[model samples]
Target chain A: MGEAPLSWPDGNDRVPYWIYTDQGNYERELEKIFYGPVWNYVGLECEIPNPGDFKRTQIGDQSIIVVRDAEGGVNALVNRCAHRGVKICEQDKGSFSEIMCPYHQWTYDLKGNLQGVPFHRGVKGNGGMPADFSMADNGLDVLKVHVRNGGIFATMSDKTPPFETYMGNRILGYYDRELDGRSLSLLGHSRQRIGANWKLMLENIKDTHHASLLHVFFVTFGLFRVDNDSRVEMDDTGLHTALSSIRGKQELNDGTAQMRSFDSNLALNDPSLLDVVREFDGDQTVVMQTLWPNVILQQQSNTLATRQIVPKGPNSFELHWTFFGYEDDDEEMTARRLRQANLMGPAGLVSMDDGQILERTQEGILAHPNEQGVVELGGRGTDDADHMVTEVALRAFYKGYRNVMGL
Target chain B: MTITPELRSEIADLANAYALAIDDGELDRWPRFFASDCLYKIIAKENFDSGLPLGLLMCDSQGMLQDRMEAFSKLNVFGPRSWRHMLGAVYTTGSEKEISARTNFVIFETLAGKDTHILCAGEYRDIIIREHGALKFRERLCVYDTTMIPNSIVRPI
Candidate 1:
């Protein structure tokens, strides 16, 4: 089939629209991108800290079990039985010596090697004539795995770029500053489904300009003001970008529009929720890194998480927002973090309204598939393209996507 | 075990009134169901087991709960829809003034001419208290049995 043309505003040819909706494009992504030479974020090191620890995870629709073996070495193996294609690791995550499939009781070690198959040797030595059937030949597929600063990554393809090279200097710097050897803690998780294309989901997040206007909760609470000066730095690769901004503090007596009501008295009611205010430099900025294709690295409003987008069907996608904090946080701090988590989850004050809007936006797309969205928010010129609030970042995403898809 | 007739009647009335207020979209009246200092959390059973603090809806203090109601009615945008909540079997335990009651409920929502289907099936773990002359909820944890919510749980379940 022929590709659909994409027309940019200023006569610059955009990538084909089929990249967003076509089935053929999805198949190519599965092969060349997801299963290709890209490093995918699996989970945090804190998730499986001890020996016999494990977590069932997916790498591009392929089920792979990530386990820290008895020797404390992390390993990832495809969750499939070699015998009849049944899943070898059935459970989501738990400690186990070996996985025993219920279908035929075929057992496999944590390394995903065939340990034993019940009745394989033949009962009473009367039957079973396959002498050459070796268990060694039938084992789970293992992928090369690595860890960087407590972050776990896996790649299906052997020729993947080094983890450091793939992440680039910009991304590594952010991780170095933010993570900073702190013991990672598992705060909680929130999942929501938005009825828009997966790319749009990533775009909506990394595009920092929407916070002031799109997210009313931010405006109401005085967490971030719209007039803040921020910059969107497009990575050298164009796939990732950094959004940095310091929202000035709202003067209590200025009578400026703040979050909730004008009465500062109500803000003091829940001291833990909206207790402190800080200068623009001290303002915690959200650095969003779109790790091409599926994973989105998000740091915003004291909330750190990696939003894993899994497209279930054409109409919708599932977003698993796993929140994390430093493990050494005190009980009070943890509670405060949990209370503050309401800023971006499904029920988050800022995010609760987003899902509904996204669903409706996609629904509206049905009316005009041929028509395209205008991405001239930052500027028209490509040279001065580093602005916080523009759809130019989306254009950068499409650049990386097209390169990956060979469009 | 002698089921107290008075306790059962009061709990039943509270459950019915709670569902009616929410489904009818009575924003201000819903807060009357809870105490001034209350904990209202509606979380999935999956998240609870995982030790995650996240909730489909987490509200501490009637003010936060009231804040959500305000957002729903005034700030947050949603489609034109109506919900019919079917509250079933109220099991009350503890003293008359301050008791713990659990009730099973199924909330049905309809939008854009679509009929109401079961959105979520959960139990309301309520900590009831008598403040002055009225019965108010000190804590209401809407614990949902189903982990995978239907489509998008936009409205409160």
Candidate 2:
């Protein structure tokens, strides 16, 4: 059978609505984009610090288990029994001696190697005559793991380049700045299921202009406005991006005066939420690094987190947010991070609007599947920008999407 | 001080009034339930059990509580919706200054034109103290069993 037809609107500016609504297109994305040669961000190495510690997570639509082996090495294994195809690992996170299937009693080691079978020599040799069942050949599907500093990324295809190469030199510089060799402590997590395409949230982070326009807290407080010193960057493939900005004062300036959302009278009743303890070696108060295919490393004020995108289907996805800080951070800094976190997550003062907008965005698009949304804020180009007023990153993302999906 | 019937009744009234203020969209009155300096956190039961210090909403002061309600009412953008909070039995114990209380909560949200559904199911763990003849929450920890949020908890649950 021939491939189902997928149409791409002319130029890099017009994004077709069908890309988000078509089930067939979504399945193609699962194959060509997620499970393809691209590197997918899984979790952090600090999460499973001890041997036998494991966490269940998703990449695309597949259930994956990231576990720490006895040798302190991390493994990303497909959470399916090799013999019976049972979905194992009920707990979201736990410590285990070995991975086991409760149904058939098929067992695997922490490294996902098949270690035991319920009846390898079935029924006291009555039915185990032709025993060519090889345990070595029946291990859980192991993903190629890349451990960088404390970040964990895995790939399904062997064609994936080295982690650094995949991130590119420019994006890697931005990544290392935040994930800088320091030991990290798991602060906590906020998991929410958003009724929008996974890519929409990625677009939200890469959207340099929306911070001030959509989030009143950002515009009124001058945390991320168009007037601030900000820039947008992209890698060679136009897949990876880093958006950074230096927070400005709350005073209404020429750039913010035009925003309808900005209200000068608004102020944080408790100013502690905006307390910025400059621990990182940079002046930028916020740096959102969006690694293609899965995650966004966020450094907003003192709060820090990694937002992982797990696509549920065509029009929905689960966002697993792991908030973290430096391991050696003082109690005050930790407190500051937690307090500042009120600005994000599901009920976050700023990010709460993002979920609503994305859901509405998809709803509106679903109403007219054949139509297209314009990504022409900056222009009809896909170049990095020194200003936030452009949608070049969004355009770049679609350009990469078009190439990967072969649309 | 001991667990008396009068004090238990007063605590129950406070809990009812608190939920009413939020469910009824009388958000301005939400902050009045707490002391001037307080700790109000809506935490996940999983995180609370693991002793992880994180919550969906963490307000450590009266000002922060006001900040949240103000954001919800004025700045934040969300779907037009209303919620009904059905609280379970309110249990209370007393001390010299602080009264410890716990109550189970189940909230059903009704978005405009949508079917009403359970938003979250949780238990409230509160430490109440009297300030100027009125009982107020000094530390209110809302640990929810439903960790996977439905879209977003727009109206504070």
Candidate 3:
């Protein structure tokens, strides 16, 4: 309590405002949570199918280049060049046989192995690199990468557990359900920069309380609601959460009468927007999972996507959406995936309200850095719940966060 | 079939009227600019160039457009704001049935108490046809170059 500026109260229900606003805490989060022994989502294997295909992305605030090598294997490398610390890959994505820092032309193979340095041999040995300078000793920083199904994740620390063990058993089931060993093809992407604490975005999906209340499209269309059959499950470490809900028809009863976002009169003129074709083996129409620290896997109807959260600062994050569908999907199925995509993303009918809400939440938190948010909706205990009326997953999330961050 | 000067003038008027409808805050009339069976999509240029079929907003029929505008006006929660849509010339090149037109556009948004900023910068690749006597958009593809949308896009661009 001496050097710490935050005065946290007991229990996971009390989330202090300082965690969202404090610069010191933010730095610690970057170190312990992001760069620490945790697997961070980089990109998908399908996004880089061909050898030499590469995509420049982020892990926390650090730039990462996820590339497929000539050997048809995926690799994750720090974007910074080993020579002059220059960002090697400037473009978002492209097919590159080799990487060269635009600043000095320091070259590297697709595996990020230092291939050549222009001045290393230096003009017929006049000003060359030292005799002991080895290319193997000076390669772009590599991260331990795990590519399973079609998804790709990387970890900076060696102490991080394997991908399967890290995700735990419960969360892995949900993760595999989406990927399912199917060949995935890229649909598209929509990016947004939100001015708010990054964790709020995670909490936003983890919290089912706002789904039926804040989104009119969700409530009016019966896509998700508290009354619907829903389940909230977390990983053993409580670092990941999956919220699944079966879509029910909207009815004007005691439940709908109490809500402000729902309107019986409001209906889609084109009902084809909700023309959901049952594909998965479950009755649940929505499965939104938060893969701690980075990505959110969204499976709302036929719209399948990964919302990658790249934290820019203490109070801001860049959300990168990678929309995809199975390669074997017929033209009609592809169209369905494309059509259903309107329900999420930046201009999503049901999701467009989220970025603004998070920014507003950040604004309020910045105003009152001493206050804390109440997470006692479902009680203090973090347990699996079969109902939507619970903040248990959030409490579990913070518990995992606090354990890793040592808050 | 022929490209007449009168037809060009009519197309220009249609484009201006479309911009004025939203800038004037008459979101109710937003869907009227399109034909009954239309395609109005707000897509990123990256995806467009890459042949990706996704969009920030994708509406196939006029009914879908109405649904989108309805969601924006009635239920979607966002700060009160206004836009100033600045458009360049609507270039027209066509066939005997419909005219294919493209125009560069930029929209600046200002919240009630905030300063004005560039909300989006993109080109509208459209297909124009006559619904009754007036020209209506059969397909309005808003391919925006702004990769990162500055917060939320509450209203359609």
Q: Which candidate is the best by DockQ?
A: 3
Instruction: Tell me the RMSD of model 1 versus the true structure.
Output: 3.6
Q: What is candidate 2's DockQ?
A: 0.80
| Off by more than 4 A, model 3 | A1-4
lDDT string for model 3 (B88-142, tens) is: 9989999637999999999999988888988899999999999888789999999
Superior by DockQ: candidate 1 or candidate 2: 2
Rank the models by DockQ, top first: 3, 2, 1
* lDDT for residue B3 in candidate 3, whole number 0-100: 73
Better of 2 and 3 by DockQ: 3
Native contact recovery (fnat) for each candidate is 0.26, 0.75, 0.87
What are the RMSDs of all candidates, in order? 3.6, 1.7, 1.5
Instruction: Identify the leading candidate in terms of lDDT.
Output: 3
- Candidate 2: Cα lDDT at B113: 87
- The CAPRI classification for model 3 reads as high
Colliding residue pairs in candidate 3: none
lDDT of 3 by residue, A282-324 (tens): 8989999999889999899999999999988888999999999
The segments of candidate 2 whose C-alpha lies over 4 angstroms from its true place after superposition are: A1-5, B94-96
lDDT of 2 by residue, A79-129 (tens): 999987899888999899899999988899988899988756769557652
- Local accuracy of candidate 1 as per-residue lDDT tens digits, A1-407: 34455333332234333445555656667788778998877877777888778888777678888988887788888888887888767666667777777788888887878888777778998665388988898878888898876777889998998988887887677666556677888766666666666666777765565666666556556565445556666666667666665545544533234333333333433445653323124445655667765777766656677777766544567777777877777776666556667666666667766676777777776445456666566654333243454666766766666667665
The DockQ values of the predictions, listed in order, are 0.45, 0.80, 0.87
